[model samples]
Target chain A: MLAASGKLDRRELCRALLADRGDLLVVAGLGAPAWDITAVGDRAENFPLWGGMGGAAMIGLGLALAQPARRVLVITGDGEMLMGLGALATIAVQRPANLSIVVQDNEHYGETGMQETHTRHGVDLAGMAKAAGFPRTMLVTRPEEVPALRAAIHAGEGPLFAVAKVDPSTLPLVLPPREGAYLQARLREAVLGPAAHHQL
Target chain B: MDRQVMESRPAAADWPDGLYELLKTHRIRQVAVVPDAGHARLIRRCLADNGMRVVSLTTEEEGIALLQGAWLGGDKGVLLMQSSGVGNCVNMLSLAITHRTPMPMIVTMRGDFGEFNPAQVPMGSATQAVLEAMGALVRRADRPEDVVPTADATIRLAFNTFRPTATLIGQRVIGAKTFGKD
Candidate 1:
């Protein structure tokens, strides 16, 4: 059953998704903790953020279509999504069964300077996701409501979107020069098993 | 290099037909492009044509990234750009080689081939060597007549072989000046 969470948002949603099997998550654009999961945890993180925004969504869509059996989640930001709005239509038309797009709408580019964006420009993200042919969607703005959203995500179907409206200023202070070794050990154990360590 | 082959080749007005042939015959549905005047006639035409989805990009490297993604997504794609932008894409080309993305492109020559601008020369001179260094198959289309078949052949070979192929078009092939006026 589809559900919503009030206290939690997409960052945690990404962590949860990463913890689970059956999905390959691509952290596109920037400002989120996806690399922390993939890089630190030693998962496959393609399409590194070099320059520009909005390219990753298209990348994620492409991966999903290519690997249809494997579930794919693209974690995109509001500003990045707005930069390549047409990609949404392309995603909608292709409608890959394994694709799930989760946009953390902080209403700004949190990584850069938290500048205002199209969402703040009064663009409706949920509406846009729907128009982009995502039959199942959710918009969560409150805290204490993320767990149920996690459940909805785990149980959801093709081309779903969970738009988590967030306050970027309140986010936890992330420690960087990241915990690559520790996270990789933990994640490798989780996904590939303890014996698989020697191979990588 | 065949003059008869060059003369018999169709013109820009025939691009839609050419593109249609490219899409249908080659079955290339995904295209990654960096904007440039050298190939603007074909690129603009392709963008408007519904035959394939044009993935417009901010940088030439991003074009390679998109092509990589498209390949991962099960679509054969091409990167279109002018010669100068080749330098911007070199690093990404490494990513392609490391991952074996089998990236292919249609590069229009701007600096060389009797280039007037000083800025266009460096990359134009470097184009073939740079591509060769990346382990890519570089084919130069020095004449208008060679473009269509060369593009067609490049697209086919790149996809089939899982290798990157580039077509460098001389100014004469794609028109030295823009459409409408001098």
Candidate 2:
């Protein structure tokens, strides 16, 4: 009995959030979030996870810590976030200012035939993140809040945690590079330029 | 933070220092760890080193993704954990295996030599075999002097050969954890 209060269209929100992205590295969680990111536009910097479900946020943390000069965003689903909730504590401890985690909370496990997730009941991911010591945390329900959330992500003074409640309607699949090696090489080449060739 | 290596006790041995130097030589900037006494010295050294980005993970499985992301970003990283933590990483090891991402893990073993805790025995005994089963090249360092060479081979295997490699720091090198001590 989840309320249908989410007014923001996920694809539009993703498009708006990533419209001005320039050299920003994105790690998309498995299933829906990956499609959301891909729907916006696929690039060498956008790493959409096909298998690593709960590992997106930590991967974002690693990328953020490694490339301090660049902005790192982790766009994931509520189910995925819940599975890797401990990552919030770890990310809070590291406090990499370049990192931002955005959860597309559709209140359902969309990939597995749209079953209700914990967020549909009473799970508060943003609250959990704030309790875990993230400096900035937000819950965006309305489309108007998207701008502020985008600003926070680009502000570069974060360990920001945001959960955007989106419609539970499923969208068409948008697949990125299926080969892990290709995705890895594309990202490396984009980040390190000619120096990537020298690495293993 | 100051770069001084924290513990100065001679009894602590130089194996941790040897491994630290090897990591530095390989330009490993990211260190993902779940704390354990056996890895304390190495963890502290990485934390104090200004050039290294030390990520304290809640679980060892997180290290797999972190290191994969590090490699994706054109940087190198290592996972420091105890043998017990190896059990936590089995499933996530597929991320490295399927992706063909190079991962170097430094594990301090338990339940092998003078182990007082029976809880650590099961996982400790299964650690090397588990890592090997997950397609990681496993090596062991039984003595203080063997640390550097084992780490060297592991690094070469991981980074150069594009394969996941692990070096198990033997109980003899790290010393057994006493029950009624501190």
Q: Per-prediction TM-score, please?
A: 0.59, 0.92
> Scoring each candidate complex against the real one, what DockQ results?
0.19, 0.61
| Model 2: CA > 4 A from native | A1-6, B1-13
Candidate 1 C-alpha lDDT tens digits along B28-80 = 66677677876666676667767677766556766775675666555567788
Residues A1-200, candidate 2, lDDT per residue (tens digit)?
Answer: 12354367888888878988887899998898888899888898999988877889988988888899999999999999998888999999999999999998989999898989999999999999999999999999887788899899999999999999888888788888788877887888899997886844
Predicted model with the maximum DockQ = 2
User: What does candidate 2's lDDT look like per residue over B58-152, in tens digits?
Assistant: 99989998998888887799999999999988878887876778899999999978888899899999999999999999999997777878989
Candidate 2 chain B worst ten-residue window by lDDT: B3-12
Native-vs-model 1 lDDT? 0.63
Give the Cα lDDT of each candidate.
0.63, 0.88
CAPRI category for model 1: incorrect
In model 2, state the lDDT of residue A39: 87
For every model shown, the clashing-pair count is 10, 0
Candidate 2 interface CA RMSD, Å: 1.1
Best model per lDDT: 2
